[model samples]
Target: MNQSFPKAEKLKSKKHIERLFAEGKSISKFPLRLVYLKTGLPEETRIQAAVSASKRNFKKAVDRNRIKRLLREAYRLNKYRITEETDASYAFMILYLGREIPEYEKIDHKMKQLLALFLEKETGKKI
Candidate 1:
């Protein structure tokens, strides 16, 4: 797996983001919520993703940025779980649900579990 989050795979469209929140399905694991929408994507793109940390929870810009970074890193490393097995393309937003700063280990573990839950729910098969 490339494991690098390239610009091509980053979710940047305002319209798409709105549609995603309106129509997307979600899987939640504490401190993380995976909101995913089934949709057409550019060729060779299985998923385009974005990460967010709520400003209300983390008032400091530094804290929010760090949380977003961790979310993105966790997703970037483990995204192969969704990319390899499924044919349909998706738009994904991984939201940080915690009020406090999170450790990398905790985020990584929850990310793996969350992705596994997503795969099972969408693919109808055990991982």
Candidate 2:
């Protein structure tokens, strides 16, 4: 499977981000929270995602950046499981709600669980 997160798949539009938070539905798995919105995207990609680390939790820019990187990596590896069957496009914002640094293994596992939860709730199908 092609498991790459290209620039086209990153959520960067300010207008879209505003609309998403204003109108999106969210699911949480402890330190991770996923906010999703169903919308029409011009790109051919089925989903576009963005990750955030709370500045309140991690004071330094480096720490927040590292967490965002880890979150993105985990999503890139696991997104294929969700994208395979869905025909409609969506926007996703993954937020890290932890107060401290995290291990990659924990992040990866939580990411899988989070994605499973998203799939279950959105499509009524277990992954």
Predicted candidate 2 versus true structure: per-residue lDDT over 32-119, tens digit per residue: 9999999897757889999999888899999999999999999999999888857779999999999989999999999999999988
Please provide, for model 1 over 2-87, each residue's C-alpha lDDT reduced to its tens digit, 9 standing for 90 to 100. Answer: 78889989999999999999999999999899999999997688799999999999999999999889889999999998888799
After superposing candidate 2 on the true structure, give the runs of residues whose Cα lies further than 4 Å from its correct spot.
none
Model 1: per-residue Cα lDDT at residue 58: 90
Clashes of each: 0, 0
What TM-score fits each model?
Answer: 0.97, 0.97
Kindly report which residue stretches of model 1 are placed more than 4 angstroms away from their true locations once superposed: none
lDDT of each: 0.93, 0.93
10 residues in a row with least lDDT, candidate 1: 38-47
Lowest lDDT 10-mer window, candidate 2?
80-89
